[model samples]
Target chain A: MILTNIESVPGLRTVEHMGLVSGSTVRSKHVGRDLMAGLKNIFGGELKGYTELLNEAREEAIARMVKQAEALGANAVVNVRFSTSAVAAGAAELYAYGTAVRVE
Target chain B: MADIIVFIVLVACGYFIGGHRERSHYRSIFAREAATLELTLLSGKAIDPAWQVAQAALVTGVCVISVDYFKSVAAGLRNLVGGRVSAYESLIDRARREALLRMKAQAAALGGKVVVINVRLETSSISGMKADGRSGQVASVEVIAYGTALALA
Candidate 1:
């Protein structure tokens, strides 16, 4: 399916709107990763592990959202948005939402 | 006594190492931004109708940058006085620019002239709270930049 974070896909026309679809997931860092991050905090740099973890989680969330759109018989998802929240000390929740539509 | 000594050492290390990392990151960001100057990044949803579009797809970039011990401690002191916390300011700035740069790189990889539309940035603090809901010194900040990349025809 075509995905765009705009009102409509470029070079295509929206033929139908399929309401809204959303997916979310919460992830927590493992103890080892948390310990390493604690040390990295002292020295200061990119938390590569956490970055990868969050990115993977976001992709999964997007995939689930896409699945929902597909089930609704939508050909594209538009006006997509992502949000991240700290669910707990080491846990983070990533949410992806968009308007599903049929494009021609 | 020993704990105080370790605290001092950590602060010293944080000062030196964190400063170096920030400087280098800025330098790299500048270079990459210049390299990708031809690619367009926009926040508005409207796209110009004149240009022929070949393809459009979702693109995203994420960055997680940590604050040094020294800056967090310095910010804590600023909290008491109620002034702008400049140390955290630079941290967030770096994270944002880095995330955008990575997004631009992805746009460039789409194999043609491209413009990113409806770009949005989301920033959140991570590892900053405990199970008891008590917030600690912000260990790191996360920034995600996403948009629709339209390859020109």
Candidate 2:
């Protein structure tokens, strides 16, 4: 399913607006690696943990959004957007949402 | 000395029990419910009653869970000599409003007049008890808003 935060997909036209769709998941990873990277910033090093955590959250949220679209019987989801919140000290809520629509 | 120790234990117990109860209450409130409404662009299609029923159930489930948790916590702390429960209220309000706003925006962007039927709300926590003495408390509530938009002929 195609998902973009943009209000309209660049090329595809929305034939039918099938309504709203969304998926979300709460997740967390040890911040130790992030802290280490920050410390290493004295010399400079990649913050692999933070990057990985964000990527995982984004993928999971997107996957869930796709499932919602499928349930709505839409072939694709347009105008997808992603959002995140630190729900707790160690955990984050990642969400992806979009308009489920049929396109030609 | 004994009285002092007893008071300390009681306070600890209050914190432990209070926190545990809060977490479970929020979890129950955040349980997931989904609904779907089908709208046919052509005439002569009947509205799906199942969708309406599902929507009612979802809304009730979420509202009840939220209100119950808030009431219980507030009552629990009422008798205690504490300054304020403002922090908890703020947390709940922020999470709930943010979730609702996100859902509403998504619905509008999809060209649906309003989100009707099959709204899903899920809640989870980030902490787990460990050997290093960390307490598990509710970190966040995730409200998943979903519904079907129909266009009639």
Which candidate ranks first by TM-score, i.e. highest? 1
Can you tell me the DockQ of model 1?
A: 0.67
Per-candidate RMSD, Å: 2.1, 14.1
Candidate 1 stretches greater than 4 Å from native: B129-134
Best by lDDT: 1
Give lDDT tens digits, candidate 1, residues A6-81: 8888888899999999999888778788888888888888888778877887898999999999999999999999
lDDT of candidates 1 onward, in order? 0.87, 0.45
The per-prediction tally of clashing pairs is 0, 4
Query: For each candidate, what TM-score against the reference?
Result: 0.94, 0.38
Per residue, candidate 2 scores C-alpha lDDT tens digits across A1-104 of 55433344334567888888988988777667534533322222123444345446656877888888898888777556555554665565777777888765
Instruction: Kindly report, for each predicted structure in the order presented, the TM-score of its chain A compared with the true chain A.
Output: 0.96, 0.79
Stretches off by above 4 angstroms in model 2 are A31-45, B1-153
